[model samples]
Target: MVFKRLRQALGVGGPSVETVLANPECRPGDHLEGHVQMVGGDHPVELTSVALGLVTRVAVESGDSAYGTMQEFGRRQVTDAFRLDPGQRYDVPFRFEVPWETPLTDLFGQRLSGMTVELRTELEVTRAVDQGDLAPVAVHPLPVQERLLEALLRLGFRLAGADVERGHLYGVHQTLPFYQEIEFFPASRYAGTINQLAVIFMTDPQQTRVLLELDKRTPGRFTGGDGFGRFTVDHATATHTDWPAQLDTWLRHQAG
Candidate 1:
């Protein structure tokens, strides 16, 4: 009996989980609908629950060290306790609410470098749990976010990379513990003044906060352009504004 229980805990002859998303691509604040297909194995079992979560690789800084780990920011429970018999099959449907602060993992139909967002299925058993394989989901940017990115490209800023950092912005309205930073190589005009630039957006239902950081080429020196600047605006305002021109003005003032 002990060996049988141990084998069950170790997931030998356990239920298999396959999560199928109705649509693999989604934007922030959107709903992700999917179904969890499960198949029982050789023995009867009592299923405690079924759940799903959105996970991503995040870089966290602690004290004087930094490490990268997979973090689950959004989670949803699909089913309550249930029983499963040998060779029994169960299909549980679920709708996961995407957080407005979810990072953009795909842009222009391309997955961002150093960024991945996946959905994981979880099944609770007696003494142990089983985590399913990661199902990749492409998180696209919202309209306002797309506009801002386009403006950067139009202003001659080259994309370097992007990643999620497990921390909050200094002066932004953040609802989550972590934020995403999209780094870019400075435009040629500002190359002499700033080394690079990073953009972060903290979004909610009402408005979006745009955070820009200008990295100085020479540190410890008084460079007008080396600091953080935040711009708060709504969706309609951002849609109508000439971001290329406005961004240029912001950079010029920083260079002075």
Candidate 2:
């Protein structure tokens, strides 16, 4: 009897969980609607709580070596204190608001090489917690963001890769702990002058602040330094501005 009790306490008879998102594709500042379907195990179990979180892999730097780590950026509790009878089934629906600063995982219908976002459901049994597999989610760019990306493409910058860095920018009002850097390789015209460019967008409902970092190429062994430029515009203004021209001016100023 004692052994059986111990086994149950250790989650041998815990419940199983499967989460389904109504739609896997979303944009930043949007809401994700989903349902958590659960089935009781062989025996009745007491559940402490049920919750969901948004998780992704981020690049972390330590002691001159950099490694990637899985991090949870957002979480929401779905339920608390539930009793599951043997073989019983229950469904819990949830509407989670995606943060305004959520990173983009897809562009032009293609997934970024190293970028991913997933929805994870966690079922808390007496003393054990079971986490479900990552439900893949594709986060697309906002309207303003799309315009900027299109402009860059028109200027001959190709998408290289993107990653989230595990720290705050030097002078940015970032609500989240990390920021996404969308990288691009310079066009043929500027290949000799610039190695690459990384862009970061800091946004709110009112406006977006665009940060540009240009990595210059050098002839000598010593690497060239990064040049920075910042600009702010409202959503309406973003659509009308001549981004390619403005970007060209910025690059010229940075290179000189």
Candidate 3:
């Protein structure tokens, strides 16, 4: 009897948790509304807290090697400490605000390759943490962001893949530890000059900043090298600008 009581006290049959998002689709600077549905186990348990976090996969460079791991960039508390009675059903609703720097996982109604974003649920019982299953969340691009992408496409750049890196970009102000890079394949028109490209977008409520990096296929002493440029403008200005023309001009200058 003592062994059985010990197992139960150790959270062996504490409680089961399942999180349900009202709508799993969101954009940066948007809100994720959901509820944490929980059921009491074989006996009553003391709950410490419940929370939600925005999580993504990031690539980390360790000297000569690189690896991928999951990281949470944002978190919000759902409920405080409480006692859960056996067979009781308790549902905690939440509205987690997605940060403006949150990485993108989807564009044009399609999921990007090598990209993933999910909501991580954590429940603590008497100081012992119990992590619930991850709930998938699809983060799409904002209007200005979409326009930037469309401009790249119109300039004949093919969408490749995207990944989050675990470091900072120089000269760019960022609140998050990691940033995302959207890669692209060069067009035939720029055949031997440009091999590949990567674009990074940083935006806040009022303005958007863009960084363009190119993998040049230069012939001389520089075989395959990288060149980059940056620009910042308000949302209205970004929407009005001719992206294809601007990007084309910039590419020509870098390729020269």
Candidate 4:
């Protein structure tokens, strides 16, 4: 009997989990749900609780390359303290409110050009120690966001690279700890007039903060071309709206 109980406590009976997406392609400010299962071991053992966390891999900017790192964005307890007997098992279900400003992993049903995300699980044992990482999940992007990217490409912006930088925009209300930056090289037509353009999309369910950083070449008069032109844009625009016209206007001003 003791051995049976020990087995139960030790999770020898195994555990299973199920996750459901209320709205997988959420813009931001959405909710997600999942269920956890625990089976009894050989004997009855006092079980603690179960937990789930949303995790993602991030890269901090170094000199030439990005430094890979991991961060936990959200966590929730799914089960209450309880005890399990030999050959007995229980299923526990849970729901989690995904932060409205959760980063986008994909765009318009297609995975983002360069981003990955996963959901991790943890199990609390009777001894207060936590065992986790049973599984991982993938997050994709929304349609409207895809359209915006298409527009940028259509305007001749070439994707240089992308990265997630920690901190707030100099002049924006940002709730998330980090923001995504997709950069581009000036198209050949504007290369002589512009150096490079960096685009940042700060988003929540309600709005997106689009910031444009333009570096202009300084014509050398007496000495040589020096200095650079820099600017930024922050507009509360919905993703569904057309942006090419406004973007073209911004690019023309920068080129001038």
Candidate 5:
């Protein structure tokens, strides 16, 4: 029975955790709910605080290669000092708002593969020492976002990848340290007109802010004054309208 006892002891001794958000996805000024579960180990321990972080992965350029780093963009303290006895268990819950300028993870109906936004939990057992993470919360895309992405695929643009990058445009109010970029490759018809398009959505409760940046392989003689278009669409229209035609119309104006 020694081997069986050891195996069972090692397997079930660690902490068990769970995280949830009443509304997993939110507009600006909206709140996210979180729940965490912790179970005592073989011995008793003093607890400090339970912390939650809103994190995203970012790719940074370093020399000839690129590397990904986890950025903890937002953090919250959910529970204060406590103590746990051997074989005891507990749960802590919280509610917090997503930042107003949170980037769009999806535009229409597709998943942004390279994009990962996680609500992570950290157990602070002491003044400065804390366990890295217990669980991750997923934030899904909004309805208006789904509609817009559906429009893109219909327009023949293929999803390249998406990421959150650090920086701000010349004229925009940015609250978070980074912004999300959902990128696309031009389909055949627009391949000759444009190389790639990067779309960004800055959202709040009332509107969906859209930023489109195009990298064009200019033809020999056609002169286009600018290569990018930035605009905003209200939430009502984004959900009620057909975006493929609207997007095509926007692209036509860009070509002219």
Candidate 6:
């Protein structure tokens, strides 16, 4: 019994954990329901804690260079300390709230390129921590966000790329450490004035805030600078708002 206890303390053959999400797709400010299933190993063990975290890849700037790293933006504890016996099975249900500033991984039922969101489960043993398999999840855009994207598309802008950049946006209220930028190539009508445009969304339960950055094009060796425009709309008014016309006005004002 002592040898078995020693092994258990060392986490030589502790319990295994697997997380399953009931709904693999969700929008921002939503809840993801799941369960952590555990199966005992050769010996009984004491588990300190079990938690879930939302993780994604972010770009980090170092000196004059930048690199990619995995970052966890949100975490929630699933269970407290517990004891598991040999050959026993346990299931712990969890409902985790997805952050309001969570980045979108899917658009129009299709996964966006270079975007991924995962739920990570961590099991704490006496002397070791075992990480469960990552559960991939799709975070769709909110109704307001969807409307804005549709307006951009209607204005002849094509999605060039999207990425989550480390650091906060200037003059924006951000809960997460990173912000997502959806890049677009300017339409033919605006190509002469701007080279590209990028959109960022910061949302809450009440309203959705949008930031538009226009990268103006210049001649000679000097490149043009960025012009920013910001606006907010209530969730209820998103579907009824004239997004295309409003966006055109904003663009013209910025260009002028």
Model 4, CA-based lDDT: 0.58
Count of residue pairs whose backbone atoms collide, per candidate: 1, 0, 0, 15, 4, 0
TM-score of predicted model 6? 0.91
**In model 2, where do residues sit more than 4 Å from their true spots?**
1-13, 219-224
Using all chains and alpha carbons, the TM-scores for the candidates as numbered come to 0.91, 0.91, 0.91, 0.70, 0.78, 0.91
Model 3 error, position 43 (Å): 1.5
In model 6, where do residues sit more than 4 Å from their true spots?
1-12, 219-224
Encode model 1's per-residue lDDT on 1-256: one tens digit a residue: 0000111222778766667788878889998887787777888889888888899999988999999999997888899999877889888988899999999998766778899998877788778777767788889998999998889989998888899999777756787789999989988988887788999989897788889888887653345536778888797677889989999998787665
Q: Candidate 1: where are CA atoms >4 Å away? A: 1-10, 219-225
lDDT of each: 0.82, 0.82, 0.83, 0.58, 0.67, 0.83
Total backbone collisions, model 2: 0
Model 5: how far is 42 from its true place, Å? Answer: 3.7
Cα RMSDs, all models: 5.6, 6.2, 6.0, 7.0, 5.9, 6.0
lDDT of 4 by residue, 1-256 (tens): 0000111223344433334333334444455654555566555666677777776666676778777677667777877788766656576666666664466665534555656555566667656554444343434433445556667777787877666666676777777677776667877767887777776666656555567666667653313433322232223434545667766776776566
Query: How much is 204 displaced in model 4, in angstroms?
Result: 3.1
lDDT of 2 by residue, 1-256 (tens): 0000011222566666667778888888898897887777888888888888899888999998999998887798999888988889888989988888888999987888789898877777666776656787889998888888888999999999999989888877888888899999998878888899999988888788889888888533224567878888798777788888988887777765
lDDT of 6 by residue, 1-256 (tens): 0000111223557666666788888999999987887878888888899989999999888999999998997898889999889879889998999999999998876778789889888888778776665788889999999999989889998888788999988788888999998888998778888889999999999998998888887532224567877889899888888889999888877765
User: Lowest summed-lDDT stretch of 10 residues in model 2?
Assistant: 1-10
Better of 1 and 3 by lDDT: 3
Q: At residue 128, what lDDT does model 3 achieve?
A: 81
lDDT of 2: 0.82
Pairs of residues clashing in candidate 1: 225-254
